[model samples]
Target: MQQSEALCPKFEFAFSILSRKWTGLIIQTLLPGPKRFREIADMIPNMSDRMLSERLKELEGEGIVMRTVYPDIPVRIEYALTEKGKSLESVMREVQKWAQQWVDC
Candidate 1:
């Protein structure tokens, strides 16, 4: 019998981000385009504002999400995928396809 090698560091790192609660959904939500914080909260039902805020910060730190602040009567903010984040579109789509086919929930 052959022993399996340890997971690649890059793969491990990627999973570390993806495996976080609400991370993938947040990424998916932003895939189409930029959105305000409230928009994201609405799209992903049941995710608390605090959790979403934390996850967005994590993603921003990861260079996956870019947060933009607009100056206006009320300072508006929006979150969008960076080029690095946009790169995950194919991966996310593939996961969605798999989930549709095999995920029971």
Candidate 2:
């Protein structure tokens, strides 16, 4: 089946991913650089490891994120944005700008 079709019959694309509580945050985190699984987990301290892993898997399956495995002593895996994921950067930036107007750091 097609992508939209896969998400259909129940949860649509928006509700399936973007509408999730921490999904947007995870996308934002990947904007900076490729991050390891632990890095994403650390960045999103409130989100459980299982939840993060699930989200990553979901995103990967959606063709938004790329999972890279390094050949080394142990093995290091990292997650980075695919072209589709990077396309959301503009949307994220706009959201950031809007939030900054109210939320102060």
For all predicted structures, in order, the TM-scores are 0.92, 0.82
Top of the candidates by lDDT: 1
lDDT of all predictions: 0.94, 0.89
> Candidate 2: how large is its RMSD?
6.2
- Which residue segments of model 2 deviate by more than 4 Å? 1-16, 103-105
> What's model 2's TM-score?
0.82
Q: For model 1, name the residue pairs that clash.
A: none
Per-residue C-alpha lDDT of model 2 across residues 18-45, encoded as one tens digit per residue: 8877899999999998999999999989
